[model samples]
Target chain A: MNYTSIECASSTSEQFVPMSPAKTLKVYWLETKFEWLKTIRNPAFALPAILFPVIFYLFFGVLMNHGNVQAASYLLSTYGTFGVMGPALFSFGAALAVERGKGWLDIKEASPMPASAQIISRLIVSMIFSLLIIISLGIIGVFFGGVELSVFQGALLSVILVFGGLPFCLLGLALGMMLKAESAPAIVNVIYLPMAFLSGLWIPITMLPNFLQTFANFLPPYHLSQLALKVMQQDVGDSVFTHLLALTLFAVIFFVFALVAHKRKQN
Target chain B: MQQVNSVKHSDASQVVASIQGLNKSFSNKQALCDVELQIKSNQVLAILGSNGAGKTTLINTLLGRLKIDSGEISIFSSQPGSLAVKQQTGAMLQVASLPETLKIREHIQLFQSYYPNPMDYQKVIAYAGLESLQERFSKKLSGGEKQRLLFALSICGNPKLLFLDEPSVGMDLSARQSLWKAIRDLKNQGTAIVLTTHYLEEADSLADEIVLLKQGAIIQRGTNEQIKACVSSTTIRFTTPSYPIDFNSVAYLISHDVSGKYTAIQTNELNQTLISLLTKYPELEDLSVSRAGLEEAFLELNKDQLAQSKTGKSVINKGEAA
Candidate 1:
């Protein structure tokens, strides 16, 4: 209860000037990567996103050969799309909601870090998990089903699909920014299952009802799977270019919407 | 009167953040109205208010996390949430939820890399009193411990200005005192602090300036001495002897309470009343006269609003609900 206004006055001499945006982003990137490493280090969060798809693929592709069609090749592509979507939606969207609920988003916004870095890092982290799932699914497809593809083909497919999945990952981020953590699982599931089902990831869009076929084409996942299907055959189609453009457009729209929403909620 | 127009000052030393006529709303609800605030360098500006008093809204606006309906905000002479301004600012918001999966130390380390020269991990750990809790995952820590770890993370960046909203919400008294000391230490290092708290005592004891906000407008702003002048009455508490003093005899007496062996009186005339009390009740023991606490001052400032709210017609209360 002693008054020390004099001391308080003298202390304001030293000021901290902020770093440039690029420097701030660089720092944020390393921090986010480290954060991703921390999350993946835990068996609980890391194990499920990585292992669930692998296990599901094994059960459906190898163990249960219910149909006349060779399940290996068919399930490989379908499950690969499923695998990528798992991390993009489950980890990115769900984690976004949970983090927002906890007020971590506020903390990040209040920091010296670049705003774009926060979203980009989370997207990158999600993609990393997606990449792992793709690799696991691809290996299983090769070893079990006798699917013959050169390393170049396999590597090329991985690159294309990973990049193709970016739009979905961004879409999940937008959902996370908009929805509450408790409601995230439900909301994400609403979008996730439909895209997975109607987009030819589980069953080909051609086999679906005429209505769903048209609906699936509008979704990024349909374009993604179509691109993946063509790439696995060592070919790129007109659909690939169209899908990439559509996905990029979707990413931009969602990205801006999420940023604005986040900014609004924060203030 | 030496007028300090908290808004016009441009020198870094004069102000850490300068806000002018800020207005905000949520759908149809007006959350803030003509809110102007000035947070000077190295001073602890405690924003005191009840729940939904636009404390969070004001903080968010300063951080540029939320867009204002109308106003000008300058943090370190840059816009709020600007990278340059943010680099100088560190905040421990009421809503901060740590990533549960990460250990305390790793979180600290990760945040440290975001700043060019963050405080040493050991120092932040020691200051926040989180040495033992550093290895614990954020989710594993208790509420109080989580607050400490977050407090650690906030200071790790060595920010020039720090914002803490309800910083001691989950802390024990001892921890609260220690945290206040740490805040003072930070102030000594030239870090300006703008803290929001419902605990009036914390503000009374720690703040260099206290700005009490009600319905988004500042009801009162001043140092403790300046605020203490707002108290129109003095309080006198004492143990009375067998002779019971009649309340009617004391002209300045505003109110009196008798409980067991003690009698307390609140009065307006301090000197004349004390003289009269000595003459009338020489046996009065343990006598004490003191100015009003922040709680009393706050209640006085807020009495009209509280009364209106009691009548179920408070504008701010209604706005908050909407």
Candidate 2:
């Protein structure tokens, strides 16, 4: 296609000019950058997402555990899972609901911005926040709690917990699409806190009642925390493949819910 | 007026977009019924209507945001909302907002990245008159300033076709004037604009063609003057020391309103009404005669439609009735 001629053309033409790969990448990059900037500047999201897990880890993993390496290591893995979930859920769930209510999403829909750019940007920002949360928890766990871990274990745990946020991001996306802006934060909290506790993110699953531990088998966060614990050799006697399969199934289910909610909204 | 004429004369042959037999309904209520419209390059097409008249629906359908029940919409020779069409189209929809934490410059830059070809950053800023407020976070800006930023974002793509839905709703007088100036500049540069506004004066001053929609139908479509001519009435204003008791009985008088200093009378038969008024009260002073404005024409057209529907009679064009 003659780009200049198309620009100058007065009449409508049938030709479709695809955007270049570099420009497409630039769009995604800019979208992700601004999403990160917006969320970081929001004290409401930034403060809780970074601080809550660190505070919880200091009190539970360090102060309360009394320098027990076993307990500290166990809490570190679970707290890491807990920390990453905050950003993924709140950023996607609450922020998306608020934006949708404000009609900002409509403007984006009407624009040439690819729909995937919006989703991908939020996903990327959630992962970035996940990384921050893991590192913060790691610092508290190592410096204060006397937990010992090799570099390989630390890196593997961080990677697992950080990426494990994907299913939760999808879940948040579903909630954001389904809930009203006014109730999104409270509702996400209603879901987030209880799910975290039941999944053994706050305490080890073995400590929970037997029925509750059985119930944890059905929750995505439980699988995620188990995967993170597997990195530290502290998880229950389940195959890694079982946990992986469970998380994958949960991701597919959440994605399907998000897709359905999105379609319902469009109609 | 000269700009409108020049726009019509220069690039009127190019149809940037068009809709044929468009129909849309929301469940049971018809939102748009067999609508047809042609948007030409360099011309401002004003979709004038009151609330619930399907102006938004038509724009949404053209933007490919809503699917029409049975119709064809072609923009840039492609389906509405297609990437090719979106690449060349810019829209500032009503009641839309921006993320509060992003600075004006960042917002513009991000929106610019969405298009294959975008306007220069400085040019977009200048167009929106945000030279000094580039660093200001959107949360800190006033309502008008936020609207200006939204306008800037819409034009970031340097679109060939632009849709402005009630663009000046919250803008102050000066902000509105600047926006009008920017719109004119874009039109002069050959951008086709679809403006939906209830501000009849805005439509009057900016539109090369006015389309009046009522209850999901086009009641009238013509030039500003032609639409005004539909009412076929002239307004006469004069001040009298004592109010005339029987002014309502004047020949051919359509309506009358008395304010503090002047009593304005609208009549289809201008000469006859003036003669009768003058003969009855020779003291009438400060007399002035002017054609009915677009607002009066719009009200008259809508009123005629309401009367027709009420009476179970086919809608008769008031222009032809006159």
Candidate 3:
């Protein structure tokens, strides 16, 4: 069959013909902003992600433990970790699973944007949600719980909680890749609620049974909480290196599983 | 607007996409066999098949969503899914679902940003007849509305090549007609299209070329008329006034449905059979020739194997013959 390629060269006039890094960056920014918008607008994710930790803190750290300075500082650090963890896991973990199940991921794969742009956007949005949670908790802590910290300590704690969401994001990725969309929310809750409590994010591990405290030594959130607590001079557990190593190990493990499952799905 | 990377070629036939020796499998079931196809610019190639017939796999491979086990595929002279090809290509996949939280306009704008050069968002909305639903959340739209939105997103990139997998699956009659008009407009503007659908009339109306896939292989490929004619035989019907049409004397006679008033005869060598019949029965009256419909041709061509796979999940005549 003879085919005439008339006007084939007209493709030259397209704006981003070469797809420069600048344009790629623009794609990342666009995806991130849209994702952030979707996150904030979704009551299923927004109400719980933004409000739950603050509400929980007001009830437990501020009201129940009113005028208890030590408990206020400890619970403030732990609740911040708990708060940051919800959005990270729900957004990356449950959202990705649902997106994958709905075939949205496939549509994304077929688009002109780079694959890394999708991940980068999700990561940035996760960080932003974590920041909002940390800031919200900080205000509630300073005013109501009377939890005090220097500027340096506050900055360090903010940094830890914001970035500390990474391991959970990786965990969510693995779960998203491995589990069904319907199962993701239930499974995340299963892992999240228990891990938070077991790791002493709800109550200090020191106050828990000795065996439970020993068990906290192995959990990622325990390390994250301890690092957050260190910001207020309230470190009750492992050395900073141990916490960092444990978190790093979880991140690596989750990352590997996510990569493997993702590859398997595509193949 | 994103400009795809340019690659010079000796042949200027504007091959929008091509695949050679393509093969893929899932576990023990082969999803795609050794398939080779070429698509030129401004052409619409309709892939026709039932469920599990490798239609989805072929579309997925072309879009670079699934890795080909072994084969060579290219779009615009670049590897499939390469940035250059991606900039110029668009797809509405069979399994795709849009985010419910986004409004119609947001979805279109977000997808348009992915491309370097895109049609104006308003033009896309106008083309898709999505003007009224622009500000409405996607979750509020009906099924047909969602399909239209997806179609709009696919074309918003000003893509040179578009893949629409059952693009009208959930559309109402009016919406489907409007979608067809939008697709025809794109084709008129020189966009090459690859469409897969269960609707035979869709292919008859839009496809410049048609490929009939059965069990991961192309059983037939041609223009609409050519495929309709290529079903291996046609049935000639006539009512004889005096002399009877003799079936034994005619060549390529496969069978006959003879009645006292009228008769229908099947023959592969339709011309020869007609010539013989005319010679034998000069008084034959009320004569007519009818070729099989594309749907019947499809079913008959793959009747044997399709009868065997026998799974009833997809659109079908399942387990009937098995």
Best by DockQ: 2
Question: In DockQ, how does model 2 score against the reference complex?
Answer: 0.46
Per-residue lDDT for A152 in model 1? 84
lDDT of 1 by residue, B1-322 (tens): 1113321332334565677788998888888888777777658899988888889888888888888889898766667877667766789987556787788888888778778677888899989998778778877877778788778878988777899998988899888988989998887666789989988888887899988777777777789776666766688889866877877777667667798788877777888788887887788899998888778677766656556465343223221232
Per-residue error for A128 in candidate 2, Å, reads: 1.2
What digit string (tens of lDDT, one per residue) describes model 3 on residues A1-267? 435442453443233376667766778777888898887778988898878898998889989985897888888899999998898888888999989898888877888877777777888998988888888888888888888877888899999998999999899888888888878899989999999999999988889999999988888899999999988778885589989999999999999999999888778
Clashes of each: 4, 0, 5
Evaluated at residue B106, the lDDT of candidate 1 is: 82
Q: What C-alpha RMSD separates each model from the true structure?
A: 6.4, 4.6, 6.4
Give the candidate order by descending TM-score.
2, 3, 1
Question: What lDDT would each prediction earn against the true structure?
Answer: 0.75, 0.86, 0.82
When only the first chain is scored, the TM-scores of the models are 0.84, 0.94, 0.92
In terms of DockQ, which candidate is stronger, 2 or 3?
Answer: 2
Weakest 10 consecutive residues, lDDT, candidate 2 chain B?
A: B313-322
Docking class of 3: acceptable
Whose lDDT is greatest here? 2
Query: For residues B2-101, could you state the per-residue lDDT of candidate 2 as single tens digits?
Result: 3344445555436778787889998899999878788877889999888999999899889988878998887877788888899889999875567899
- Best-fitting candidate, scored by TM-score: 2
User: What's model 3's lDDT at B280?
Assistant: 73
Rank order by lDDT, top first? 2, 3, 1
RMSD of 2: 4.6
Tens digits of lDDT, candidate 1, A172-210: 878888888888888888888877888877665667899
Give all TM-scores, in the order shown: 0.84, 0.92, 0.85
